[model samples]
Target chain A: MRARFWIVASLGLAAAALLGVALGPVGLSPAAVWAALAGHGDTTTVTIVQAIRLPRVALAALVGAALGMSGAAMQGTLRNGLAEPYLLGVSGGAAVGAVAAIAFHWNTVVGVPLAAFAGAAGAAALVLTIARIAGGRADVRLLLMAGVVVGAFANAAIMVAYATAPPESVRGALWWMMGSVDGAEWQRVTWLAAYVVIGGGALIVWARDLDALALGDDGAAALGVDVERASRRAYLAAALLAASTVAAAGLVGFVGLVVPHMVRAAGLRQYRTLLCGAAIVGAALVISADVVARTVRPPAELPLGAVTALLGVPFFLFQLRRLAARS
Target chain B: MTAAIEFRDARVRYAGAGGLAVAGVTFAAQSGNITAVTGPNGSGKSTLVKALLRRVPLAGGDIAIGGVTLGQMSLRDAARRAAVVPQREEPAFPMTVREYIALGRFPYASVWSTSDPGGDRAVTAAVERAGVGGFLERHTDELSGGEWQRVRIARALAQGGRLLVLDEPTTFLDVGHEMAVFELLAELARDGMGVLLITHQLNLVARFAQHVVLLHAGTIAAQGPPNAVMTGGILERVYDWPLVVARDPAVGAPMLIPLRAPSPVTVHRPMET
Candidate 1:
């Protein structure tokens, strides 16, 4: 059963990546797309596929994988289904850093993600502090509320930072904040891949600790897990992944929130399998969503973050209702 | 041989609380024996257990498992020495009984260790012993209360420690299952594992436990064999209730039955209408 799920998910991701490469404003046939990928096609077709669509699709997949695995890690460590990077203010925090960097014209690949990581870490710390102050970390509602407050604060900070920026820089930051992979370059894709691989690998390595954590703090402690240490490590890794994605593709909201659930709904329970599955499925979902975003409006492009949120909010509400009923 | 678990004037105080939750209590649970701790609400039964598991830090004194002080051992080492069935827990996500049971091997397995035949054998033995093999494929959330309780016990058993600690293990069980659990504990004790049980069921403790510790207001009121600690006078004083201690016909263990409080208002007999 597990192997079958992996096979199907891999196939879905491949199909989604194909569609993402093939279905742009200047449509290309599958045969052309294939030939372009192999460096044997007409120059325009090759440039469009290799230079334009390939990097975008790859970046989308990387961002999606990062967000998806990060979300799974967050949800497992916090033991709350609603705990997503965007919802937990981690993305908002990263946005604050990335936006500041852009406003200041410090657009280097490493510099932006680094600043974003700092911001994401800060936001995570703030949210946890707020949750602790309100009651305890065990209270999911309090954590969510803390995230909302931090996210609102991040937005205000972003606006304040934008006040003194050049009009062109502000325009770029604004579009970036709305989330678009429109200018996907090979450099950005390679950098983001390193972040996702390192951060997501750490999450997978700590998957057993996450499994114990799902049993609650005391339960995990009894199972020999250093609960506080393990949870903190997971939170940092998740924050890093979220920050990297925000740096690459702006705040693509709910791939993290939605992909883990899709994986779980397919009966994948263990964290190792769940995290991997979420990565594959998340890549497919985001790539597919990006395809729709560009195709739906033709010449005018829709924001990738907006498209994901449109699909994610309803699912979020449905999950909330189920949680309410259970409790 | 050293005691399986020993507490030397252990003390625990919650932050911001007025008094110590577990106030300098001392006891020892020996291998091949079942030691039961019984107390009323807020008398520190669960707190003592928590202190033993290091879930709560000790304010003063010491706890030693197999002669190694808690300060000297990591959580992993402690877990290998003693397995615990906590008072209450619910999995955050859905997992099958088999998957849940595998969690017991956490202390034994390392980060990169994927599969362990020994761990598998332990899990299978636990499933059989706890009688939870009937629904290995069932989700934990779908289990009945009794089944969940038993499943938790099975997980502890799979942990493969020399000592087992349980707090209120039979809370939701029916009478038969409750008896069966006590019997299982007895059987484990006979097999040379030390068992520490915290419960409100004095009668079952009388029948099963080789030693009993009675607590009152975070302090030990009495500690001895069942006949010595289960006496009418001691139980009545500690419990602060009218009760009688009688002999069990089946096993000759002391049985406690609390008496009703005297009526404050005299009831007039109903007229035959």
Candidate 2:
């Protein structure tokens, strides 16, 4: 069952990547896209596929993979089905950093992501602290409440930053915040890949700890897990993934929140399989969403984040209802 | 032999609470014996188990598992010596029964180690012993209450510890299933494993437990053989309720039958229309 899930997910991801590269403003055939990928096509086709679409698709996949795995780790460690970096205020905090960098004109490739990382780490710490203070870390309602409050604060901070920025920067930041991968570069893709690989690898290694954590703090401790340390490590890794995705793309919503549920619904419950499945499926979802975002309107492109949110919000509501009924 | 687990004047105090939850309680659970701790609500029965599991730190005094003081042992070391079945647990995410039972091997499974033949053998044995082999592939959420309880016991058994600790293990179980659990614990104890049980089932404790400790107001009100601890005088006083001790017809062990508060006899007056 696990092997079959992997095969299907991989095929879906490949198909989505191909579609992302082939269908765009210029609209190249799959054949042309294939030739361009091999560096044997016409210059225009080569430049369009290799220089523009290839990097964009790669960025989308990496960002999706990062968010997907991070979401799984967060959900597992927190033992809350609704726990995701986006919903937990980690992404919002990263956006705060990215927006601040843009407002101050410190838009260096490395500087923005680093600032975003710091902000994400800080936000994760703050949310945990708030949850701890409210009662216990095991209180799912308290944790979500803390996340929502922190997220609201981050949005307000972004608005204040926008108020002081130049019109051009504000316009660009608005599009970015809504989320797009329009000008994807190899440098950005490489950096995001590094973050995803390292952070996602750490999550996979700590998957057992995550499995134990699902049994509750006392339960995990009785099973020989250092609950506090394991949770902290998971939070850091998840924060890194969330921050890097925000730095790469803008505020792409719900990929993190939705992907793990999709994987679990497919019957992969263990953390290792669940995390890996989420990464593959997330890549496919985002790549497909990006394709639709670019193609939906001929001359104008939809925000990638907006497209995902459209699909994700309904799924989130459905999940909420299911949980309520169960409890 | 030294006790498999010992709590010497152990005390546990929750932060912001006015008093110690487990106040200077001392006891030893020996191998090949079932030691039962029973008490009313708020009498610190569960608190002692928590301290033994290292979930709560000892405010004063010491707890030792397998002759090693808790302060000197890592969580893994402690787990290697003792396994616990908590009073209640619901998996946050449902997995197959096989996967759930395999979690018991976590203490022995190294992070980098992918496979463990020994752990697998232990898990298989546990499944057989707990009689949960029939539904190994079913998800935990699909299990009935009895099945879930047995599955938890299987997980604890698979941990391969010499000392088994359970907190209210029979809660929510039907009469037959509850008796089965008690019998299983007794069987394990007879096989030279130390079993520490904290429960409200006084009658079952009397029948199966070799040593009984009755707590009241965070102190040991009585401790001795079941026959000594199960007397109506001690039980009624500790429980603060009216009850009688009767001999079990089958096992001859003491059985407690709690009585409702006595009501005054009054002549029935018909209600006027």
Candidate 3:
């Protein structure tokens, strides 16, 4: 049964990558996609597939997998079905980092993700500190509210930076603020892929800690999980994932929120299955959403983030209703 | 031989809080016996359990497990020796009973260990022991409260620890389920595991627990066998009410019957929120 699910998810991602590659301004047939991918097509077709479509498709998959895995980790640690990377203020923090880098002329490929990761770390620290002050993991509500406050504060700082920047840089910051994958290059994808593997792979390895967490902090401790240490690392990993995706593309929302629930609805309870399923389904969702974003109107692109939310909200709502009925 | 778990003047005070939650609590849970901690609402019965597990820090004093101080041991070492069953089980995501039970083997698992037959064997044994074989594949949310409690106990059992600590395990159970749970705890105790139960069910304590500790306002009011501690003098003064203590009709367990309060029991104080 598990193997079947894995095959289905992997096939879905592969099919979605092909579809995303084929549906852009210049539509290509399946044979053409394969021919171009295999370097057997005309020069224009080869460059289009190899240089343009391939990087965009790869970045979409990587971002989806990273965000999706981070979402599962967040939900598992906070023990809330609605917990997602962006909702926890990580994307906002990354935006602060990236925007600050761009505004200050420090927008090197390496410098941007580093700054975004630093911002994400700062947000996580603030959230954990607030939770501790409210008396040690007091309630999920406290953490969620703290996230909103921190996100708002980060957004304000980003705006201040944007206001002080030159007019040309303002358009660039706006594009970074509203997420897109138009600028994905091979070099950036390689670096982002490393972050995704390091963060997502570690979370998958710590699946037992997530299992222990089902019983609560005290219960988890009694189950022999190093709850404090494991939870801190999980939080950092989740932040890194969210930040990396933001650095690679922009703030692609709803993949984190939508993918995990999709995995859960398919009846996956374990973290390993959840992470793998989320990665595949998340990749499919983002690629499909991006396809719609670029192709909805010829030569005009919609923001990829808006398209994902539009594509994902109904599924999220249906799952929520089912959850409410069950409870 | 040393007791299964011993407390040496254990204390717990919430940081920056006005009062200590647990103060100078000293006791031991001997193996092969069920120990009960009973107290009023404001008392620190829960705090005592948390202190023993080191979930809450000891503001002062030390706790020893089998003659060794708890401080020197690692988290995994302590878990191998002791397991706890909480009052409620609220999993944010869905989990099958078998899957939940398998989590007990987490302490025994490492990164390189995959597809553990040993974990499966332990889970099977625990489920059978807890009499949850019928619901092994059922979702946790689908089970009744009693069934859920049993599954949780099975998970704790599967952890393979010598000491079992239960923090008000029967809070949400019905009368029959409550009695059944206590009976289960007694059976586990008889099997040579040290059982520490914190509860307000005095009648159940008298019936099942071998030893009882009465707590009042974060301090130990009394500790002895149930028969000695469940008398009218200690309970009435502790609860500030008139009460009659009588032997059970079938068994010799002590049961409390309230006569009339000198004044109506005060309502819970309102909070600022």
Candidate 4:
């Protein structure tokens, strides 16, 4: 099974990398794509592939993987099937931070990514603090409630920013708000890649803690697990991974929520395997969605968020109906 | 042998409550014996159990397991020495009976490590011993009340602790299941695991428990063998009602018959100076 996972992951990375280079406005054929990747193609094709589309593709894959792993970690820690980074208020918080940074024109010193990271961290802190104050004792139900309240407040703040921002800033802010990988740069992709590797690695290593949590607090505690410590570590890792994704790719909705559920529904429950599988599937899902978003309009670009929502609504509706039918 | 559990001047005070729930209670549950804590409602029987497990904070005094103070021992080590099945605390996860029983092995597991295979074998054996082997594959939440309680017993058995503390283990069980659980407890005591249970079932406690400790208004009202403690005088005083206690011929256990519902006094005398 481990070998199979590695084989599949390698295949996915290869396919994504290949497709990333081969599919663009200036389409490089597979042979040319390989040649350009190997530093043997024409200057124009090489520059467009290397400088423009490759970075976006890399950014999408990295951010998608981060979101996927974090979603798995979040769900596992809470022992809830529906938990995700968005459910923890990280994405919404990051969105608020990014939007605030853009609206306030704080792009000169450290840029929107750092601002977005700070925002996500702040949101996570607030949700955790409130849940603790409520004395829910880190119970899954209370964490979810905190997420809902925090997400709502963050959305309200975002609306206020959108509602009151100057007309010129709104267009740019809206683009970020809508979630786009269009203008991704190598520097941003590198930052996101490092964050995902570190944060996702931590989750994979803490997989056993998730298994312990599945047994509830006493069971976990009885097994020699410091339940509080395990949960806190998982929460911090999930928050950081999520914040980095939003920092890199803006507020890409549903990728985190959708991927983990899809993996669990497929009968994979182990955290390490679940995280790995979600990462692959999430990256593929987002990349495919991006492909559709880009191709749906020849000259104009549609908001990636719109495309994801358009696709996600049907998937979500289907899941909801199935759940209702089961009940 | 040092008792598996000792409550020395133990007191449990709940938040926002002035008095101790189990005040100045001292008792030792000896190894290879079943000590039953029984009392009327709101008499702090459960409080004493919690204090022993360190689940509730003690307002005063000390609780020691195997002569090691619970306060000094790490919570994990304390768990290793004792396993508690709280009154009617339901399993919320959708894990299978085997999985639920396997949770008894958690204290030995590391956060980043896989479960020990030895613990897994012990859990399976414990389930089989508890007579829930047939229901091993079923989801825990799907089990009937009797079956669920038995499963909880299996988990406690698998915990491999010196003392098994149960709080109202038969709360929702029918008569047959209740008897079945008590029989199982008797077997556990024979196997040298000290068993302490908090219960409201006086007749069952009289029949099965080797020792009985009665609580009234957060203090130990009486403690002794069942034959000594299940007297009519103590019953009437504890319950604030007239009651009769007599031995049943078939089971040779003491049984109770309440003679009157608290009939209020008809006339009041002047207060004594």
What DockQ do you compute for every candidate structure?
Answer: 0.67, 0.62, 0.65, 0.30
Model 4, residue B180: distance off in Å is 2.8
**Residue-wise lDDT of candidate 2 within A196-252, one digit each (tens)?**
999999999999899888888778888988888999899899889989999888788
lDDT of 3 by residue, B1-273 (tens): 788888888889987888898889888889999999998886888787677667789999988877778888888778778887765557777688888888888778786463355778878888888999998889888899899888889989988888889999998799999888888898899999999999989988998988999998888899999999999999998877679999988898999887764556764533421
TM-score of chain B of each: 0.94, 0.94, 0.93, 0.93
**Candidate with maximal DockQ:** 1
DockQ of 1: 0.67
A-chain TM-score, model 2: 0.95
Cα-based TM-score, every candidate? 0.94, 0.94, 0.94, 0.82
* Rank ordering of all candidates by DockQ, starting from the highest: 1, 3, 2, 4
Tell me candidate 1's TM-score on chain B: 0.94
Please state the CAPRI-style docking class of candidate 4: acceptable
Q: How many backbone clashes does candidate 4 have?
A: 4
lDDT of 2 by residue, B134-235 (tens): 999999989988888889989999999999999998888899999888998888999999999999999899889989989988889999999999999999
The TM-score, computed over Cα atoms with residue i paired to residue i, of candidate 3 is: 0.94
After superposing all C-alphas onto the true structure, candidate 1 shows an RMSD in angstroms of 4.4
